[model samples]
Target: MFRLAAVVAAVTVMATAVVAQTDVVAERKSVMRESGKYFYGALPRMLRGEAPYDQATVDAAFTAFADSAKKIPGLYPESSKNAPRTSDYSASPKIWENKADFEAKVAAYGKSIEAARPKATSLDGLKEAHALVRAGCDSCHDSYRVRH
Candidate 1:
Protein backbone atom coordinates (compact mmCIF):
# COMPACT_ATOMS: atom_id res chain seq x y z
CA MET A 1 0.00 0.00 0.00
CA PHE A 2 2.81 2.46 0.88
CA ARG A 3 4.68 1.83 -2.41
CA LEU A 4 1.52 2.26 -4.47
CA ALA A 5 0.72 5.55 -2.80
CA ALA A 6 4.26 6.82 -3.45
CA VAL A 7 4.03 5.92 -7.10
CA VAL A 8 0.73 7.71 -7.53
CA ALA A 9 2.07 10.81 -5.81
CA ALA A 10 5.13 10.87 -8.05
CA VAL A 11 3.04 10.60 -11.17
CA THR A 12 0.80 13.41 -10.05
CA VAL A 13 3.81 15.62 -9.40
CA MET A 14 5.28 14.90 -12.80
CA ALA A 15 1.97 15.67 -14.46
CA THR A 16 1.72 18.94 -12.66
CA ALA A 17 5.25 19.89 -13.64
CA VAL A 18 4.51 19.23 -17.30
CA VAL A 19 1.38 21.33 -17.21
CA ALA A 20 3.20 24.18 -15.52
CA GLN A 21 5.95 24.11 -18.13
CA THR A 22 3.39 24.21 -20.91
CA ASP A 23 1.76 27.23 -19.36
CA VAL A 24 5.10 29.02 -19.10
CA VAL A 25 5.83 28.40 -22.75
CA ALA A 26 2.39 29.65 -23.72
CA GLU A 27 2.80 32.80 -21.69
CA ARG A 28 6.20 33.55 -23.22
CA LYS A 29 4.86 33.11 -26.71
CA SER A 30 1.96 35.41 -25.99
CA VAL A 31 4.36 38.09 -24.87
CA MET A 32 6.43 37.73 -28.01
CA ARG A 33 3.41 37.98 -30.27
CA GLU A 34 2.05 41.05 -28.55
CA SER A 35 5.42 42.72 -28.78
CA GLY A 36 5.69 41.94 -32.47
CA LYS A 37 2.31 43.45 -33.16
CA TYR A 38 3.26 46.67 -31.47
CA PHE A 39 6.56 46.87 -33.34
CA TYR A 40 5.11 46.16 -36.74
CA GLY A 41 1.95 48.19 -36.33
CA ALA A 42 2.96 51.33 -34.48
CA LEU A 43 6.41 51.72 -36.01
CA PRO A 44 5.30 52.23 -39.60
CA ARG A 45 2.82 54.90 -38.62
CA MET A 46 5.54 56.88 -36.92
CA LEU A 47 7.94 56.36 -39.78
CA ARG A 48 5.59 57.35 -42.61
CA GLY A 49 5.01 60.89 -41.33
CA GLU A 50 1.38 60.07 -40.58
CA ALA A 51 2.03 60.71 -36.89
CA PRO A 52 3.99 63.40 -35.16
CA TYR A 53 7.26 62.33 -33.57
CA ASP A 54 6.91 64.04 -30.26
CA GLN A 55 9.10 63.06 -27.38
CA ALA A 56 6.24 61.44 -25.56
CA THR A 57 5.26 59.19 -28.49
CA VAL A 58 8.82 58.35 -29.41
CA ASP A 59 9.64 57.60 -25.79
CA ALA A 60 6.67 55.31 -25.39
CA ALA A 61 7.38 53.33 -28.57
CA PHE A 62 11.07 53.03 -27.87
CA THR A 63 10.35 51.89 -24.34
CA ALA A 64 8.16 49.15 -25.70
CA PHE A 65 10.86 48.12 -28.17
CA ALA A 66 13.50 48.01 -25.46
CA ASP A 67 11.29 46.04 -23.13
CA SER A 68 10.43 43.55 -25.84
CA ALA A 69 14.07 43.04 -26.74
CA LYS A 70 14.94 42.36 -23.11
CA LYS A 71 12.30 39.63 -22.88
CA ILE A 72 13.50 37.61 -25.91
CA PRO A 73 16.35 35.87 -24.09
CA GLY A 74 14.21 34.74 -21.21
CA LEU A 75 11.42 33.44 -23.44
CA TYR A 76 13.56 30.72 -25.05
CA PRO A 77 15.96 29.28 -22.54
CA GLU A 78 18.38 26.41 -23.27
CA SER A 79 16.63 23.66 -21.31
CA SER A 80 13.51 23.49 -23.45
CA LYS A 81 13.95 21.49 -26.63
CA ASN A 82 10.46 22.08 -27.97
CA ALA A 83 9.57 25.25 -29.81
CA PRO A 84 7.14 27.37 -27.87
CA ARG A 85 3.57 26.53 -28.86
CA THR A 86 1.91 29.73 -29.99
CA SER A 87 0.51 31.33 -33.11
CA ASP A 88 3.03 32.28 -35.80
CA TYR A 89 6.11 31.35 -33.79
CA SER A 90 8.42 30.88 -36.72
CA ALA A 91 11.32 31.21 -34.38
CA SER A 92 13.12 28.30 -35.98
CA PRO A 93 14.87 25.66 -33.95
CA LYS A 94 17.85 27.23 -35.62
CA ILE A 95 17.55 30.01 -33.04
CA TRP A 96 18.42 27.53 -30.33
CA GLU A 97 20.39 25.34 -32.76
CA ASN A 98 22.93 28.10 -33.19
CA LYS A 99 22.49 29.61 -29.77
CA ALA A 100 25.47 31.94 -29.94
CA ASP A 101 24.30 33.62 -33.14
CA PHE A 102 20.78 34.02 -31.78
CA GLU A 103 22.04 35.62 -28.62
CA ALA A 104 24.28 37.97 -30.53
CA LYS A 105 21.46 39.10 -32.81
CA VAL A 106 19.11 39.76 -29.93
CA ALA A 107 21.79 41.68 -28.09
CA ALA A 108 22.58 43.75 -31.15
CA TYR A 109 18.94 44.70 -31.59
CA GLY A 110 18.78 45.92 -28.00
CA LYS A 111 21.93 47.98 -28.46
CA SER A 112 20.69 49.62 -31.68
CA ILE A 113 17.46 50.82 -30.06
CA GLU A 114 19.27 52.00 -26.96
CA ALA A 115 21.62 54.04 -29.10
CA ALA A 116 18.71 55.57 -31.06
CA ARG A 117 16.73 56.73 -28.03
CA PRO A 118 18.69 59.93 -27.50
CA LYS A 119 19.05 60.88 -31.14
CA ALA A 120 15.33 60.89 -31.81
CA THR A 121 13.94 64.40 -31.39
CA SER A 122 12.15 65.68 -34.51
CA LEU A 123 10.31 63.78 -37.23
CA ASP A 124 13.44 63.30 -39.35
CA GLY A 125 15.42 62.25 -36.33
CA LEU A 126 12.63 59.89 -35.36
CA LYS A 127 12.61 58.43 -38.86
CA GLU A 128 16.30 57.71 -38.60
CA ALA A 129 15.80 56.16 -35.21
CA HIS A 130 12.92 54.10 -36.51
CA ALA A 131 15.02 52.83 -39.36
CA LEU A 132 17.81 51.80 -37.03
CA VAL A 133 15.45 50.00 -34.70
CA ARG A 134 13.48 48.41 -37.54
CA ALA A 135 16.65 47.22 -39.20
CA GLY A 136 17.45 45.15 -36.17
CA CYS A 137 13.99 43.64 -36.05
CA ASP A 138 14.01 43.01 -39.82
CA SER A 139 17.31 41.19 -39.65
CA CYS A 140 16.16 38.95 -36.83
CA HIS A 141 12.81 38.16 -38.43
CA ASP A 142 14.43 37.41 -41.76
CA SER A 143 16.86 35.03 -40.13
CA TYR A 144 14.74 33.34 -37.48
CA ARG A 145 11.04 34.18 -37.61
CA VAL A 146 8.72 33.11 -40.45
CA ARG A 147 6.21 35.59 -41.79
CA HIS A 148 2.51 34.93 -41.78
Candidate 2:
Protein backbone atom coordinates (compact mmCIF):
# COMPACT_ATOMS: atom_id res chain seq x y z
CA MET A 1 0.00 0.00 0.00
CA PHE A 2 2.84 2.40 0.90
CA ARG A 3 4.62 1.61 -2.37
CA LEU A 4 1.44 2.28 -4.36
CA ALA A 5 0.96 5.62 -2.61
CA ALA A 6 4.58 6.58 -3.38
CA VAL A 7 4.12 5.74 -7.00
CA VAL A 8 1.00 7.83 -7.26
CA ALA A 9 2.73 10.77 -5.57
CA ALA A 10 5.64 10.52 -7.92
CA VAL A 11 3.39 10.45 -10.94
CA THR A 12 1.49 13.47 -9.71
CA VAL A 13 4.68 15.43 -9.23
CA MET A 14 5.89 14.49 -12.68
CA ALA A 15 2.58 15.51 -14.20
CA THR A 16 2.67 18.86 -12.45
CA ALA A 17 6.14 19.57 -13.75
CA VAL A 18 5.10 18.70 -17.26
CA VAL A 19 2.13 21.03 -17.02
CA ALA A 20 4.32 23.89 -15.85
CA GLN A 21 6.74 23.41 -18.68
CA THR A 22 3.95 23.21 -21.19
CA ASP A 23 2.41 26.42 -19.87
CA VAL A 24 5.64 28.34 -20.20
CA VAL A 25 6.25 27.02 -23.71
CA ALA A 26 2.76 28.01 -24.78
CA GLU A 27 3.17 31.49 -23.32
CA ARG A 28 6.46 32.02 -25.10
CA LYS A 29 5.03 30.84 -28.40
CA SER A 30 2.04 33.16 -28.06
CA VAL A 31 4.27 36.13 -27.36
CA MET A 32 6.39 35.36 -30.39
CA ARG A 33 3.35 35.04 -32.61
CA GLU A 34 1.96 38.37 -31.40
CA SER A 35 5.19 40.21 -32.11
CA GLY A 36 5.71 38.42 -35.38
CA LYS A 37 2.72 40.34 -36.70
CA TYR A 38 4.96 43.37 -36.80
CA PHE A 39 8.15 41.70 -37.93
CA TYR A 40 6.62 39.41 -40.50
CA GLY A 41 3.58 41.49 -41.28
CA ALA A 42 2.86 45.18 -41.76
CA LEU A 43 6.15 46.68 -40.63
CA PRO A 44 8.28 45.13 -43.33
CA ARG A 45 5.90 46.03 -46.05
CA MET A 46 5.71 49.63 -44.86
CA LEU A 47 9.48 49.85 -44.68
CA ARG A 48 9.79 48.58 -48.24
CA GLY A 49 7.04 50.88 -49.58
CA GLU A 50 4.98 47.84 -50.40
CA ALA A 51 2.36 49.14 -47.99
CA PRO A 52 1.20 52.64 -47.15
CA TYR A 53 3.11 54.36 -44.39
CA ASP A 54 0.91 54.46 -41.33
CA GLN A 55 2.33 56.07 -38.24
CA ALA A 56 0.13 53.91 -36.08
CA THR A 57 1.50 50.71 -37.61
CA VAL A 58 5.10 51.85 -37.21
CA ASP A 59 4.45 52.94 -33.63
CA ALA A 60 2.70 49.70 -32.85
CA ALA A 61 5.54 47.66 -34.33
CA PHE A 62 8.19 49.33 -32.20
CA THR A 63 5.94 49.16 -29.19
CA ALA A 64 5.40 45.43 -29.64
CA PHE A 65 9.10 44.87 -30.22
CA ALA A 66 10.01 46.77 -27.07
CA ASP A 67 7.38 45.01 -25.01
CA SER A 68 8.36 41.59 -26.32
CA ALA A 69 12.01 42.24 -25.55
CA LYS A 70 11.16 42.81 -21.92
CA LYS A 71 8.93 39.75 -21.67
CA ILE A 72 11.15 37.39 -23.65
CA PRO A 73 13.99 36.82 -21.20
CA GLY A 74 11.61 35.91 -18.44
CA LEU A 75 9.79 33.45 -20.66
CA TYR A 76 12.77 31.13 -21.01
CA PRO A 77 12.74 29.58 -17.56
CA GLU A 78 14.89 26.48 -16.83
CA SER A 79 11.72 24.39 -16.77
CA SER A 80 11.21 25.19 -20.43
CA LYS A 81 14.67 24.15 -21.51
CA ASN A 82 13.57 20.60 -22.18
CA ALA A 83 10.26 21.30 -23.89
CA PRO A 84 9.67 19.30 -27.03
CA ARG A 85 10.67 21.02 -30.26
CA THR A 86 8.23 21.80 -33.05
CA SER A 87 8.98 21.80 -36.72
CA ASP A 88 8.07 25.47 -36.88
CA TYR A 89 9.81 26.93 -33.82
CA SER A 90 11.09 26.06 -30.37
CA ALA A 91 13.56 27.34 -27.85
CA SER A 92 17.04 26.10 -28.65
CA PRO A 93 18.85 24.09 -26.00
CA LYS A 94 21.73 26.49 -26.56
CA ILE A 95 19.68 29.08 -24.66
CA TRP A 96 19.91 27.10 -21.44
CA GLU A 97 23.44 25.84 -22.11
CA ASN A 98 24.65 29.43 -22.28
CA LYS A 99 22.04 31.13 -20.20
CA ALA A 100 24.05 34.20 -19.35
CA ASP A 101 24.98 34.80 -22.94
CA PHE A 102 21.41 34.32 -24.06
CA GLU A 103 20.21 36.87 -21.51
CA ALA A 104 22.85 39.35 -22.56
CA LYS A 105 21.65 38.98 -26.11
CA VAL A 106 18.12 39.73 -24.95
CA ALA A 107 19.38 42.84 -23.19
CA ALA A 108 21.07 43.96 -26.37
CA TYR A 109 17.80 43.41 -28.19
CA GLY A 110 15.98 45.61 -25.70
CA LYS A 111 18.55 48.33 -26.24
CA SER A 112 18.10 48.10 -29.97
CA ILE A 113 14.35 48.45 -29.60
CA GLU A 114 14.76 51.53 -27.44
CA ALA A 115 17.22 53.04 -29.89
CA ALA A 116 14.88 52.36 -32.76
CA ARG A 117 11.66 53.41 -31.08
CA PRO A 118 12.36 57.11 -31.46
CA LYS A 119 13.50 56.68 -35.02
CA ALA A 120 10.33 54.84 -35.97
CA THR A 121 8.33 58.04 -36.06
CA SER A 122 8.54 58.21 -39.81
CA LEU A 123 9.05 55.71 -42.57
CA ASP A 124 12.47 57.11 -43.45
CA GLY A 125 13.46 57.18 -39.82
CA LEU A 126 12.24 53.63 -39.36
CA LYS A 127 14.28 52.62 -42.36
CA GLU A 128 17.39 54.07 -40.80
CA ALA A 129 16.91 52.21 -37.52
CA HIS A 130 15.61 48.91 -38.89
CA ALA A 131 19.01 47.36 -39.59
CA LEU A 132 20.22 47.68 -36.02
CA VAL A 133 16.94 46.27 -34.69
CA ARG A 134 17.12 43.39 -37.18
CA ALA A 135 20.71 42.68 -36.24
CA GLY A 136 19.69 42.27 -32.62
CA CYS A 137 17.00 39.77 -33.63
CA ASP A 138 19.39 37.88 -35.89
CA SER A 139 22.04 37.63 -33.20
CA CYS A 140 19.65 35.86 -30.87
CA HIS A 141 17.71 33.80 -33.38
CA ASP A 142 20.78 32.54 -35.17
CA SER A 143 21.99 31.00 -31.94
CA TYR A 144 18.93 30.51 -29.76
CA ARG A 145 15.88 29.47 -31.83
CA VAL A 146 15.32 26.01 -33.25
CA ARG A 147 13.28 25.94 -36.46
CA HIS A 148 13.39 22.23 -37.18
Candidate 3:
Protein backbone atom coordinates (compact mmCIF):
# COMPACT_ATOMS: atom_id res chain seq x y z
CA MET A 1 0.00 0.00 0.00
CA PHE A 2 2.83 2.38 0.74
CA ARG A 3 4.50 1.57 -2.57
CA LEU A 4 1.25 2.18 -4.42
CA ALA A 5 0.77 5.49 -2.65
CA ALA A 6 4.30 6.52 -3.58
CA VAL A 7 3.70 5.68 -7.21
CA VAL A 8 0.49 7.68 -7.24
CA ALA A 9 2.19 10.63 -5.63
CA ALA A 10 4.98 10.48 -8.16
CA VAL A 11 2.51 10.45 -11.04
CA THR A 12 0.62 13.36 -9.56
CA VAL A 13 3.76 15.42 -9.23
CA MET A 14 4.81 14.66 -12.80
CA ALA A 15 1.37 15.51 -14.12
CA THR A 16 1.32 18.75 -12.18
CA ALA A 17 4.67 19.82 -13.61
CA VAL A 18 3.56 19.00 -17.13
CA VAL A 19 0.39 21.01 -16.66
CA ALA A 20 2.32 23.99 -15.31
CA GLN A 21 4.64 23.98 -18.29
CA THR A 22 1.83 23.81 -20.79
CA ASP A 23 -0.04 26.52 -18.93
CA VAL A 24 2.37 29.14 -20.28
CA VAL A 25 1.81 28.02 -23.84
CA ALA A 26 -1.92 28.03 -23.30
CA GLU A 27 -1.86 31.53 -21.87
CA ARG A 28 0.18 32.91 -24.77
CA LYS A 29 -1.95 31.13 -27.32
CA SER A 30 -5.06 32.71 -25.81
CA VAL A 31 -3.51 36.16 -26.08
CA MET A 32 -2.28 35.51 -29.63
CA ARG A 33 -5.70 34.39 -30.74
CA GLU A 34 -7.20 37.53 -29.29
CA SER A 35 -4.66 39.66 -31.20
CA GLY A 36 -5.30 37.66 -34.37
CA LYS A 37 -9.02 38.28 -34.11
CA TYR A 38 -8.40 41.79 -35.37
CA PHE A 39 -5.39 41.17 -37.59
CA TYR A 40 -7.02 38.24 -39.33
CA GLY A 41 -10.64 39.05 -38.75
CA ALA A 42 -11.94 42.56 -38.10
CA LEU A 43 -9.08 44.53 -39.63
CA PRO A 44 -9.13 42.54 -42.83
CA ARG A 45 -12.84 43.12 -43.13
CA MET A 46 -12.35 46.82 -42.72
CA LEU A 47 -9.42 46.91 -45.12
CA ARG A 48 -11.43 45.14 -47.78
CA GLY A 49 -14.27 47.53 -47.06
CA GLU A 50 -16.38 44.56 -46.05
CA ALA A 51 -17.05 46.33 -42.80
CA PRO A 52 -16.83 49.91 -41.68
CA TYR A 53 -13.88 51.02 -39.59
CA ASP A 54 -15.46 50.10 -36.32
CA GLN A 55 -13.55 52.06 -33.72
CA ALA A 56 -14.96 49.86 -30.99
CA THR A 57 -13.45 46.72 -32.50
CA VAL A 58 -10.22 48.58 -33.24
CA ASP A 59 -10.04 49.82 -29.67
CA ALA A 60 -10.68 46.40 -28.23
CA ALA A 61 -8.30 44.63 -30.59
CA PHE A 62 -5.32 46.96 -30.17
CA THR A 63 -5.95 47.22 -26.47
CA ALA A 64 -5.77 43.45 -26.28
CA PHE A 65 -2.71 43.54 -28.53
CA ALA A 66 -0.95 46.06 -26.29
CA ASP A 67 -1.94 44.13 -23.19
CA SER A 68 -0.70 40.92 -24.72
CA ALA A 69 2.57 42.61 -25.72
CA LYS A 70 3.08 43.47 -22.09
CA LYS A 71 2.65 39.82 -21.29
CA ILE A 72 5.11 38.53 -23.95
CA PRO A 73 8.34 38.69 -21.96
CA GLY A 74 6.71 36.80 -19.12
CA LEU A 75 5.33 34.20 -21.49
CA TYR A 76 8.61 33.17 -23.10
CA PRO A 77 10.52 31.85 -20.12
CA GLU A 78 13.63 29.73 -20.68
CA SER A 79 11.69 26.51 -20.17
CA SER A 80 8.94 27.56 -22.57
CA LYS A 81 11.29 28.64 -25.40
CA ASN A 82 11.62 25.10 -26.67
CA ALA A 83 8.85 23.18 -24.97
CA PRO A 84 6.72 21.01 -27.21
CA ARG A 85 4.17 23.39 -28.53
CA THR A 86 0.52 22.70 -27.87
CA SER A 87 -0.05 23.80 -31.46
CA ASP A 88 1.78 23.41 -34.76
CA TYR A 89 3.76 26.59 -34.22
CA SER A 90 6.29 26.81 -31.41
CA ALA A 91 8.74 29.33 -30.15
CA SER A 92 12.22 28.80 -31.47
CA PRO A 93 15.19 28.01 -29.25
CA LYS A 94 16.72 31.27 -30.44
CA ILE A 95 14.62 32.92 -27.79
CA TRP A 96 16.62 31.19 -25.11
CA GLU A 97 19.91 31.29 -26.99
CA ASN A 98 19.62 35.02 -27.55
CA LYS A 99 17.70 36.05 -24.50
CA ALA A 100 18.61 39.71 -24.65
CA ASP A 101 17.58 40.06 -28.29
CA PHE A 102 14.32 38.22 -27.68
CA GLU A 103 13.49 40.50 -24.76
CA ALA A 104 14.31 43.58 -26.81
CA LYS A 105 11.94 42.42 -29.50
CA VAL A 106 9.18 41.99 -26.95
CA ALA A 107 9.80 45.52 -25.72
CA ALA A 108 9.61 46.76 -29.30
CA TYR A 109 6.22 45.12 -29.64
CA GLY A 110 4.90 47.05 -26.67
CA LYS A 111 6.25 50.27 -28.14
CA SER A 112 4.64 49.52 -31.48
CA ILE A 113 1.31 49.04 -29.76
CA GLU A 114 1.75 52.25 -27.82
CA ALA A 115 2.60 54.22 -30.96
CA ALA A 116 -0.39 52.78 -32.78
CA ARG A 117 -3.21 53.08 -30.26
CA PRO A 118 -4.04 56.75 -30.77
CA LYS A 119 -4.18 56.21 -34.53
CA ALA A 120 -7.25 54.03 -34.05
CA THR A 121 -9.40 57.13 -34.36
CA SER A 122 -9.41 57.28 -38.18
CA LEU A 123 -9.38 54.77 -41.00
CA ASP A 124 -6.11 55.91 -42.56
CA GLY A 125 -4.59 56.11 -39.11
CA LEU A 126 -5.83 52.63 -38.30
CA LYS A 127 -4.38 51.31 -41.53
CA GLU A 128 -0.98 52.67 -40.58
CA ALA A 129 -1.29 51.40 -37.04
CA HIS A 130 -2.24 47.96 -38.27
CA ALA A 131 0.79 47.93 -40.53
CA LEU A 132 3.10 48.85 -37.68
CA VAL A 133 1.58 46.28 -35.36
CA ARG A 134 1.86 43.54 -37.96
CA ALA A 135 5.45 44.49 -38.72
CA GLY A 136 6.37 43.92 -35.09
CA CYS A 137 4.65 40.55 -35.04
CA ASP A 138 6.21 39.46 -38.29
CA SER A 139 9.66 40.56 -37.26
CA CYS A 140 9.47 38.57 -34.04
CA HIS A 141 8.08 35.50 -35.77
CA ASP A 142 10.84 35.58 -38.34
CA SER A 143 13.46 35.60 -35.63
CA TYR A 144 12.02 33.57 -32.76
CA ARG A 145 9.01 31.56 -33.82
CA VAL A 146 8.70 28.30 -35.71
CA ARG A 147 5.29 28.43 -37.32
CA HIS A 148 5.42 24.99 -38.82
RMSD in order of candidates:
2.6, 1.5, 1.8
lDDT of 1 by residue, 9-109 (tens): 99999888777667667766776656566566665676776665557766777777888788888876654456445565545767778888888998999
Model 2, global lDDT? 0.85
lDDT of 3 by residue, 16-87 (tens): 877777999899888888888888899989988999888888889988898888888888777665567578
Q: Evaluate residue 1 in candidate 2 and report its C-alpha lDDT on the 0 to 100 scale.
A: 100
Clashing pairs in 2: none
How do the candidates rank by lDDT, highest first?
A: 3, 2, 1
> What are the runs in model 3 whose C-alpha is more than 4 Å off?
1-9
For model 2, residues 36-118, the per-residue Cα lDDT tens digits are: 88887888898778999898877777878888898998899998888876439888888888999999999999998888888
Question: What residue runs in model 2 are displaced by over 4 Å at the alpha carbon?
Answer: none
TM-score of each predicted structure versus truth: 0.78, 0.91, 0.90
1 against 3, candidate with superior lDDT: 3
lDDT of 1: 0.75
- Candidate with the larger TM-score of 2 and 3: 2
RMSD of 2: 1.5
Candidate 3 similarity to native, TM-score: 0.90
